[model samples]
Target: MFGLGAYRRWLRSDRVRLGRWGERRARAFLRRRGYRIIARNWRCPAGEVDLVAADPSGPIAFVEVKTRRDEHWAPGQQAVHERKQQHLARVAQWFARRYGLKDRSLRFDVIVVVVPETGRVEVRHYPSAFRPPC
Candidate 1:
């Protein structure tokens, strides 16, 4: 039997490995879709956006990525609660203002990452997932 400390360490390591794997899957999916990745793991006082990308149309997108091993509890997109949405909007606004992108078009997106036990990853991208604050 594993001691408490050993179990905790195992859990932490597992989480870290899962996170990195999810991020890699997200990047690969985006690249295959022809979207140019501008940033990853962008953080601010408000919140963090997992990925930011731009298309040929000049619209900048802020993406929220949720990864899960199973869809038993809820779908990955459903994980973005109301509070999380608000934080994402705030952070996106800050990003726009800081970069003087006010006049440019912007959008919010969500990417759901589902990793099966076989290690295959499925990513679903939802464009314009939410509206920015007025």
Candidate 2:
């Protein structure tokens, strides 16, 4: 039946599916760059870190992946504004404390992906993308 409930559910699921797909692509890109995958979709009450990876030598990265279809009005990286960065920083702090990684350096990264219905998927990686007040 064409009801609001079904529509809402569909919207939620669609978003989830898209997020997962983007995360998957982001993970691959990080791996190719020699980042060891530490966690995916690490979440806390404050927010979620799409990907947590360890750099080659030291320090950890908290990645945010934004994927959009072709012709997005704005670049994906811009979505992680000051407020969003703060939330993710809080989440990263919680994750570090919880995982005994407080002693290590941490950085915020962003991966912007453009997945067209047909053709190559464009990915842009911005390491040290933002400064978080952690």
Candidate 3:
């Protein structure tokens, strides 16, 4: 059996590395899909937005990217629950207002990246994934 320290380190470092790698893949995927990247890891007191971007002549997209070693843990899209969506909405609104985009169209998107232990990467994008809670 392993000690608690090793287990904790695994949780923190390995997972974070995987996540950061996924974010890079997400950015590349977004670029290939023709989304103009505005900001990444955008943060404020309220929360953090993974990516802020825009479609070609379209709405501003507030994107959340989820990365996992595999789908066995859980579907990445399922992780964005109501609470998470609400948090994203709050952050998206803050970004929009700050950037003078309040009058422009807005949307929430989800991008799921799955990296296996030693296999190909999978990326799925869900545009207009959620709407801000009323």
Best by lDDT: 3
lDDT (C-alpha, whole model) for all candidates: 0.83, 0.89, 0.90
TM-score of 2: 0.88
Ranking by TM-score: 3, 2, 1
Worst lDDT run of 10 residues, candidate 3, spans: 125-134
Whole-structure CA lDDT of model 1: 0.83
**Distance from true location, Cα of 1 in model 2, Å:** 7.3
Q: In candidate 2, residue 19 scores what lDDT?
A: 79
Task: Kindly list the per-residue Cα lDDT of model 1 for residues 15-127, writing each as its tens digit.
Answer: 77887778778878877888899889888887788888886677998888887888889998888777788888898887888778898888888888888788777888888
Candidate 2 local lDDT, 1-134, one digit each (tens): 86999999998899788878988999999899899999998888988889999988787999999988765588898999999999999999899899999789999999988888896898899999999864
Q: How accurate is candidate 2 locally (lDDT)?
A: 0.89
TM-score of each: 0.86, 0.88, 0.93
